[model samples]
Target: MAAVFATINNIAKPGCPTHCGINTVSYPFGIGRECSLDNSYSLTCNTSYEPPKLFPISSDDFEVYNISDSEVRVATLVSYRCYNQRGALGGIIKGFDLNLNKEYTFSVKNKFTVIGCDDYTLIGGADESYVSGGCFALCRKEQEVPNGECSGIGCCQASIPKGLRSYDLTLHTLLNHSDVLSFNECGYGFLVEEGSFKFGGAADLSTNYSEFVTRLESTVPIVLDWVIAPNKSCAIGVNICKGNSSCYDVEGGGYHCKCNNGYEGNPYLDPGCQG
Candidate 1:
């Protein structure tokens, strides 16, 4: 299969580099190789530094922040666990990984959030069909947490399954924060990009887990969900789509590519869809 396209329209066929300061590069993601339509969506901008950086040759801590058409957002890195002063399981412990190899996944619209008060979180991916889930934020008091509501007390959320490619994040702390430690000692988790996150209180958590990992990049941003084709299935006649562009099959598998009626743009690139 291997077709997948979302050069996501905005016409990026002239030379690529559709903006950088605010991030925007529609055309199979792009950055080099004539602005990508291949090379597995290469991207690297790095304008020599000082506020000019985009990434995705696949790692460097993943930064980019938005890409749309099917989704792309990034930020990646946040997972905490803290408690000491005899509460045990003391300080530091952060983990994160996103991968995005099989085309893309990790966007069941996002969930799997967790915030302290005896936090309980464990993102998925060791293979269990595809994705996993976690949540267990218990609260005993601290006014019983109710600022933005994550639904397990201090905070919690879960739901992510479709065909995740990779996952990481593991933070746990049950009796360690020792019943909320006056106002949450430390315990955080990540995987957002669905409404951008909103749940504040418990003093926004800070018992010094290295200053809450420097604010988790302004609090999470990861959203991913892509499709167009890469063969998780589909073989038969093998049209795959071209000119008037069209294809089907997709749900947790592969095959997407569209653009018909009146036409649009990238449908796997070429002279496929226009208007």
Candidate 2:
């Protein structure tokens, strides 16, 4: 097996800009057409921002948070619904559509979450392993909800299946906060990177809608796994590996290169590995 290290250096194409703001823009992903492996991997550096922001050339609205050899992190959307004091629908923010083509897939590291006293959320249009599912949170009183825990009391979490490329969310309320109005007036649902969220107990059930939703938007991110030659196998595709490098097939249909044993360096580059 080839040794895969996160510290592989000289990742970008020759003469291409490597740093975008605070993050390292690696190869297979680059800041421009001439640098990236292909147009699908092309990125844009927005100098309009203070430190300069990075975004996919295809999507300027989604800012790039971080990038690695195997994965990329970006800002995600939130689905929410809130009711006014009179039990009338006050606002609604639905889910979003993500189309990453064949080169990327949503990592399994994310979990679908729903937070509310009388809310239920359904997710659809994902990969086959997880085509459709829902999570529900119910509580008659604020005191019934727990702090720092998501066990379906007032907060519930569900696992998405492997190979999830895209999905949409639809939120529903059993009673529209009719019974839990005093303590809970809204419901929130989103796909978040696991271990990045913490339920704030009953206090989170407050009616201050924007603050609560904005907090999620600013802190949580969505993770996407990327691969090279996704549709071709090592035996049939053109070689991407260089000296001292070997190619291996990824489980769900893709390939990755790694440095041979007892060597170190970028496997995709010439003089691929060093002793």
Question: Where in model 2 is the C-alpha error above 4 Å?
Answer: 1-10, 126-130
**Candidate 2, 121-210: lDDT as tens digits:** 888765554588889999998777889999999999998877887787878988779899998888988888898889998988884778
C-alpha lDDT score of every prediction, in listed order: 0.69, 0.79
The residue pairs in collision within model 2 are none
Give lDDT: candidate 2, residue 131: 84
Whole-structure CA lDDT of model 1: 0.69
Per-model clash counts, in order, read 0, 0
List the RMSD of every prediction in angstroms. 13.6, 3.9
TM-score of each: 0.36, 0.89
**Best prediction by lDDT:** 2
Q: Write the per-residue lDDT of candidate 1 for residues 1-275, one digit (tens) a residue.
A: 11122346755667666655556677666777677666666778777765566777756677666576667777746777777667887646666655567777777777778888788876778654445568898887887678877888888888877677788777777588875676777787877766777777565654455655556564566777766565654463235456787776777766666788898877766777978
